[model samples]
Target: MTILLVEDDEVDVMNVKRAFKKNNISNPLVVASNGIEALEVLRSVSPDRPRPKIVLLDLNMPRMGGIEFLKEIRQDPELSSLSVFVMTTSNEDSDKIEAFNLNVAGYILKPLSMDRFISAVSTLNSYWTLCEFPG
Candidate 1:
């Protein structure tokens, strides 16, 4: 399954890439800078390129943040039920509550070390592989 990563930080994006490689996660990855761009990418999916089975979302962004994006998608019938995992630095209980309320699959705090990041990515890889997803 394809993976869509909606993050604004360039360094974090790069870290994800590196972690994926280290974990041997060869799935195709698509990147978006913010929630707005992420919505555009999701909407553009077609039969040839289905919507990503997983979305790694960041909560804080310049335009539409993760919470707003989740609300928009959950309201849209065509986009609802998307598997979204919030990967953010925000430790606020409110953010976590809101994200869970919006039906996020999981909420993960970004790891500080590269080793931890790689381990986290590996866990994700294992999770998706063990689970079934709609095509």
Candidate 2:
């Protein structure tokens, strides 16, 4: 399954890539720096650009944040079923509540250490492998 990573931080983005490489995850990965860019990529008709089966979203970002993006996607018929996992540093209970309200598949706090990050991603890789997506 293809994975879309929506993050604005350069270091975090690189870390995700490293984690993917370390886990031997060969699924195609697409990156968008923010909600708007992510939406654009998701809506694009380019055949070469594969649609992601899952999205890894960050809660804090410019233009539009994760909650707002979740609201947008959950409201759209075309995108409503897209599985999303919130990956953020925000530990606020309200944020977690809001994300769950919008039907995110999972909510994961960003780990501070590279090893933990890899472990999280590795676990995620195992998760989607067991999932069956609608075509």
- Expressed as tens digits, the lDDT of each residue in 67-109 for candidate 1 is 9999999999988978899999999999999999999988999
The lDDT for every candidate, in the order shown, is: 0.92, 0.92
Can you give the lDDT of residue 103 in candidate 2?
96
For model 2, what is the error of residue 66's alpha carbon versus the real structure, in angstroms, after optimal superposition?
0.4
Candidate 1 CA-lDDT value: 0.92
**lDDT tens digits, residues 8-73, model 2?**
999999999999999999998899999999999888846676688799999999999999999999
lDDT of 1 at 15: 96
> Where does candidate 1 stray beyond 4 Å?
none
